[model samples]
Target: MDLIDFSAIATEHATRLKAIDPLLPPPGELPDDQGVLTAEASGSAALGVLSCEKTPADAPGAQWRALVEHRLDLRLAGPDPGTALGLLLEKWQERLAESGTERGDWETAAVVIRPSRDSTGSGELLRHGFAPVRVVAVRPAERHGRGPRRTPGVAVRTATRKDVGNVVELLLELQHYDAQFGVATVRESTERALTAEVEEVLAKDEPLLWIAEVYGKALGVARVQLPPASDWSKIYVDQSGRPKLGYLTSLNVAEQARGTGVGTALAEHAHQVFDTEGVDLALLHHALANPRSTPFWYAQGYRPLWTYWYRRPAVR
Candidate 1:
């Protein structure tokens, strides 16, 4: 299919998606000259778009590495869309090999899909070996009223140089919890890297690191950062035209303190800080399969905005 055809199909997909999630952003129009693969059948079509980008490695605290990201947009008017999807994937893999991606330079392959309840695309993705990894959730900061009352005896305060050791410990605990979802792995050097990250955040003015403590013993930690001006200004804003995006990067409480009010106190504290900074929207990602996170975040008033599906084929 040509750009004209691709644009028409993409527009239709966007319309259907907006009916489901009104907050969904408009899809970008493809350039006629850009290379995009297309699979066609009688009365049906699928578009495959490929791009390679650098991202943080899978190992906890590892540096950035290259990866291939594929996006499949399907609009099937026929009886079977799965066949079109399968053909798209086959051609996508072939293109990757041709682009030197199969030489083991890329760490992984990722995809993004917005599948509704009756979306056939969901089953097709799983059948092709993709697994859901991260869920991007959003909540109107305006709705984030004063969170639960702060638990007595638990204090939330900014991290200091003296808290680096304790902060690293809490971060490692969080990483272990994340590993249960299979997207992350703990490494021997994680502590060292986490310590450096904590120090950096403490030194920065835009990103605030908060720690929850009881009697001077750290029990939980939360990291909140001001998003880039481009994203904050363009995508999320208030009536006054002020940027209103704050991202909660990581929040975790020690296993021993799970049931206690420590986690709630820490999260509420973060929200208080964001409110004070004039933020009107907050964003975060958690593993869809993480029982602890899935429930806790929803209870905190966040709703799913996007889902990232992942697949790692054996190095050829």
Candidate 2:
């Protein structure tokens, strides 16, 4: 068949499936909307659709943005999905040549249905190298519900200005502990004194700091700007009318306190507040290289909602 309108093709397929709703924004708008992508080539089966998403770092006022990278999706009946994926690979190679973007890690994925209904064909394509780069990366789902269960003796409490020094110290300690994992060893960062802007956050009635403590010793500290007055908060809102969820801007538990459950306690407490306030979700993102934090959040049920992409010189 002639080249199909690729841009609107996913939307059309989603519409045919009835999987998409009229109220929800068009395809690629929702954080988790997944569908199929098919090439226009005749004798080509539809390539599986990929759902792309990312979360945010638990830094004060930070927001998470989901990513959609459909350089190619081959999904159409009576055609070879593999052929379509191959075509996509070719197209991507072209992009790499034209744009100054370095090839990110080769990636590939299989189309998976939540319950495995009418999806035998899609699975097969993924098993084979339907696309170039061979989608082999396996990403964990974003965390949901409250968070990992509370760790005994680890109390998560809102921090006050008097606790600022202790909070900074814990953050520094936590960063240092991160060295074994190849992290550059945190500089015990964050300004020694709250900048004027940060001071305002502390002065506000709502909480500005979250600290995990035991016996009055702050083991870890995460900053937060409750009732986020930033664009990040607005993005968390269901611009499509989904319920609003409170934000978990940051969470940092000192090295000595990590496995002890300090981080979990802080997150759980945030979820509780969100639940009571009618907020629909609590979210954050960690750098891909930050292995320690990502697993910590996942065990708490935070699924990978989206991925934010960035590019810099490969050499430097």
Candidate 3:
């Protein structure tokens, strides 16, 4: 393997990912249309390829992610995939050190892998200090069995501008809980950003924001995007062509409301609205290690599509 055979690489990678999880997106015509640092395994039974790319800090969702991200994609065939991965990472780090750009506490080295896959290269990733941080989970538009029953005394309704304060409060609570898991960073700007986000949604003609209330007290909130708004998330789904995509961007329940069905009411209400509007799928991101959300989401019919594994500061 003197030269990289990208065509052969794409087929193997796509086949493996699909086999691991049917929801994994189909591989592009090429490994990646954009240029990246490519490394191939040598003196190994497995043929492994790792392509590394940097996502600048200013990109969308950068606030939650680190200042800059060095994201890698791995493709492997043959036995000993872990050894090949180790070699690829070694080469990648060598190139990074040679580049001489500072690797600090603000940068991240990340990989998005399917969680359902075998443990072929996971140990190597962990040795490199990568931790599973986030998951892109999705629920179909069709109902599975009976939907959640409306919680007693909880009135789910569209949120108005007057409800912005309560919305921000609940959203912050959600972020703070996630921060403990290292997936969320509650910066000084988080509250301001969340407030602006809530206000913007409320201003929409038909906002997809909903609040679950008990005796006029807002105990839960669900922010979602329909159709054109959710098209950005369609990238995570397989290339089945765009069906009407809906995103469950944010969901939170107050501490006092947990296990009382407030979260379920809000979630099922969003699904009802999405289904009524003819959405094909509903997508959301949750911290993989968050015990509460992991099981909560699974019980709601959402399954993991992609898992983002990352090492902070882009180094050990």
CA lDDT of each prediction against the hidden true structure: 0.66, 0.45, 0.72
**Which of the numbered candidates is closest to the native, going by highest lDDT?**
3
For model 3 the local lDDT of residue 272 reads: 86
Please give, for residues 1-316, the per-residue lDDT of candidate 2 as tens digits. 3335444445444453334223222334322223433443445534445443322233332112112122332333333444554454444345444544334422211212211122324433343333111111111123353445556667767777777567656644544544333312232222332233345556767664677787778787666433444235444222565535455655787666667677777766666665566565555545544666767766776654433222211111
Residue 62 in candidate 2, Cα distance off native in Å: 10
State each model's C-alpha RMSD to the native: 4.2, 8.7, 3.2
Lowest summed lDDT over 10 consecutive residues: which window, candidate 1?
A: 230-239
The 10 consecutive residues of candidate 2 with the worst lDDT sum are 131-140
Task: Assess every candidate by TM-score.
Answer: 0.81, 0.56, 0.87
Per-candidate clashes come to: 0, 43, 0
Superposed on all Cα atoms, model 1 deviates from the true structure by an RMSD in Å of 4.2
TM-score of candidate 1 to 2 decimals: 0.81
Q: Please give the TM-score that candidate 2 achieves against the real structure.
A: 0.56
Instruction: Give me the overall lDDT of model 3.
Output: 0.72
- Candidate 3 regions exceeding 4 Å error are 1-3, 29-60, 101-109, 115-119, 143-151
Q: List candidate 2 segments past 4 Å from native.
A: 13-25, 28-86, 100-153, 162-200, 223-241, 287-291, 307-316
- 109-174 per-residue lDDT for model 1 (tens digits): 555445332265667677767777777777777665333445578988888777888888888888
C-alpha displacement of 313 in model 2, angstroms?
6.0
